[model samples]
Target: MSEEKAVEENPVTDAEATPVPEAPRPPLARRLLRSRTVRAATAAALAGALLGAGTVAWRTDTLPLAGSSAPCWDSLGSGSMDALFGDRRTEVDEQSLHDDPMGGTGAYGQCRITSYEGDRARRQVTVNVRRLDGLRGTDAQDWPREFLSSGMVSLGDGLPGMASSSRAWIALPQACTGRDDFTGPTVVDIGMGRADFEVSPDEAPRDRTALTGALIDAANGVIDGFGCSGTYREPRDLHPPVLWDSTRTSMFCGIKGLALPAAYRKELRETRASGEGGPAQVCEAGYDSDETAVRLTTVTDPALSEIYSSDALHSGAPVKGTRGYGKIGGNRAVFKALCQTGPVMFVLEQLRPAGKGSRFTFTRDLLPAYVAAEAERIGCGPQKLTLPAP
Candidate 1:
């Protein structure tokens, strides 16, 4: 009574009262851990450290958690990517393909992939699936220069495509999209971004096997994705890489009968001619500062022919004696006709105009010869074109 009464009245405040009553005892595991030998503790700690190391490896991709995955909607597999971009880590950004059947817009999609070495971007690739449009946008002007350059060789074996180290492209099969007499053809094209840009038009390095294989794989995947009816067979007979050749007055850009003007004939020049017996043929010739002073092109693919529709119909003087119509200007001439294979376009452009007064004469003479020879080669011969008087 005396002790209890004294404690209650004083309400012990110094150094905590009664050492908090010796708190509840921990379970057996805690007791064992507290009493364990140094060796046992070290073994447990080592096991924990190993487990954590494994977790770090998995998180850092040093160890695979499961299977590897492809990017760009699985269109490009890891093997293809590795071939294209060595051993760099790659990241892809894409826009889903859209098809508007009722709208007649066809299908369009795009994917861009950037490869990284550590924190820096090393290379980039861009893939596009869309219809060629000459009427609207810059596709008509820009596409031909990039995709139809002479550096590319035909994707032979009846496949409507071409490939090189820097670029590759394939047209969709006609059976799937039906023949659109009015619009351009749909195509899948891939380019190696700045690598393609850095290449010289005169001489470009080629990786035909890797580039063509990747192109076909990408195209086939697109066809499946678009639910197309047929597939393009692998091109076993791809032609040799297109190379630049020295030009002469008698044969310019490999057109047997075509000749360069007397002024241009004297200058040292080179030419690049490509896409024989296929969708398109391009002949480019120039000297010194001008890589393409004279460009003569023939478009047999009906879809590609539409690229010149506007210029053929509206600009310059009218063309005569053809199943179709077009115009001839001082520096440029565009003509379209209905061949057995559908519509075809013949074009002759002089990037540098002829000597003062002879621009009109230059266009007139060159356009006809280009058309006649190209038409004969492509099985659309016996065709004639004439510009209006004056």
Candidate 2:
């Protein structure tokens, strides 16, 4: 065992230690021309760089985002020139379809017309008609399928409360469109929530007379469809509380009607004649200023009041002025100023419940921006963001 004592090996000295090899890097030009697995990669990258440079040059040579001018009436419906401009009903030629930066294609037998004015030449009026085809593809498709599938819900019924829910697209003028330049058609888009429907067309002595008559007829149609009874309330007056439920249940909903402003009166008349359920109530005249407007309409049920109030408070122009909640009819409210500048119409609808500690939540957080946009349409000032209410 002693004789078999092992021979041990020693570790290498520091001087004998092997060094690690360094990674190789190519020259700048070589790096730029380096090729990946694909042979055309270098060529593709070069092409992309040139394209990007061209785009930048083109944008710099063009108009600024704040002041650009484009055509307004490049598109018109096909038919006898008379059909497009005549009082008679006729089919719209599909080939004649054109893009309207301010307005989209009309649905439900609807047609749209837009006009503009000002140094910026902003769109001032937009007339819309309901067309069957338009109805099929418009925002109506984006609505809750449940509501559409159920048709009209009766206020008498306990669950979905409202007797019916219908949608009407409000043609917004190009001034209302969010484009930096007012070069599009004169019209903005709006949705009429849960409107009443009717099928009467009253006769009038003249075209203008007929248009006004049709507007009234349409208003009545909506009112009748909602089954509103008991006396009519003036635009500035409040209705009886008995007509609404104090509970958190569903109720019938509609626009907050307002008197049309003189500035837009003529356009409103023409819009009504086109048959798309006149302009949005909030967009009417008296409501067009920086001030706030309030009114009450009968809801099919009480729950609907919550929904409607929520929508109103959260909808329309964002509240301006103070940061804290304001009181109106014993309800907590927030204020927001809509359109600032341009020919666009603006409105602010306050929402708060009848009791203590009431608050309305907005559907989208960008509502303030939406309001500012509206203000810009009418050439108003910028919005002042405020701290949240306590």
Candidate 3:
């Protein structure tokens, strides 16, 4: 009892007594939590960085985060896609347009859009932007068959373009390309085909009117991309597709006075001609639905006539007339004549090899008549062509 009383009286110093209850310390986890202000600042910084990256990606066309970029360098817009491709999703691959340095090829590039239905490919649309290389022999002979065919109609509104169910083309303005000073015409052409099988014009998925709009829109885009000023107007008066009709007129291919030769009359059953007024025109007649037996074509656009310049200079015997110069041979003839508009190309060709019994000769019998008739129609008349003596 005495010892306890003594210890209590001494009463451990205030600092040692009950250790001051350690001031009721908080839990370790609670102390480690950051303040609300700090958390908000960090979240804001992360969001800003993501947004910045997205903007860059969208502009550069490097990310699909914003969905497929306007196909074909943004030349193929939403409206065109809807009209041409319908509801199908499409994929695009392009080789950016580049001008040739040596000036032989001119500006050239291509874009392809492939539409898919589920996992299978359904359709393909090819867009080519290039100078029609008449000198180098690229697209000179084959281009007319598809782009300048009877099925095609003029783009109207004074545009130098044409459209069909499966094809369309437009020439870029001379003001933009200095084309008046250049050798070849820079052009944009589109062709469509069924990805899985062959398709007839009757079964074509697109129509001429829809295709015309797509063509004009794409041309406008190309103009803008080239840093050119002005845009083309969309036409409302597009003509209906040209149909193949039985050859009832004496004038083959709808040429007013050009007669269908007896050699072709018995065998060739049908004839087709391009739209009445345009930069180019074609008349074709064939049997068994082969429209290439005899082809007579005229290219009135001065820029487009370049396609035959080299051939006119190098191909057959020299053909000189008051109008122009070119070559005349057995099966093919190419003439480049000066016109009020510019140089024009008059072509007569027999697409197939002549049979042993064949009597009609295209270059000898048809070219002179064809050129004279076509020249007059285009208002470059009084063009008399003298056939070279055999």
What are the TM-scores, per candidate, against the unseen true structure? Answer: 0.74, 0.19, 0.77
Cα deviation of 266, candidate 1, in Å: 2.9
Q: How far is candidate 1 from the true structure (C-alpha RMSD, Å)?
A: 25.3
Q: Please say which candidate is ahead in TM-score: 1 or 3.
A: 3
CA shift at 359, candidate 3, in angstroms? 5.0
Q: Residues 1-390, candidate 2, lDDT per residue (tens digit)?
A: 011111112111223321111134233123212211111223444555532232110111111123321111111212212221244222221111122322442211122232223223221112232211111223212321222212222222011111121222211111111122212221211112223222222311122222222222222222221222211111111111111111111111112112323332222221110111112112111122212122212221111112223333443343443221211222223332332212222223323221123223321222344334433333344543442443
Go through the candidates in order and give the clash count of each.
Answer: 0, 51, 0
Lowest-lDDT window of 10 residues in candidate 3? 29-38
- For residue 89, what is the lDDT in candidate 1? 79
**lDDT of model 3 at residue 321?**
64
Candidate 1 per-residue C-alpha lDDT over 142-179 given as tens digits, one digit per residue, 9 for 90 to 100? 78778876666677666677777788898775545434
Off by over 4 Å in 2: 1-195, 198-211, 214-360
lDDT of 1: 0.62
Q: What residue runs in model 3 are displaced by over 4 Å at the alpha carbon?
A: 1-68, 101-106, 180-182, 194-205, 353-356
Q: lDDT of all the models against the reference?
A: 0.62, 0.22, 0.64
Model 1 clash pairs are: none
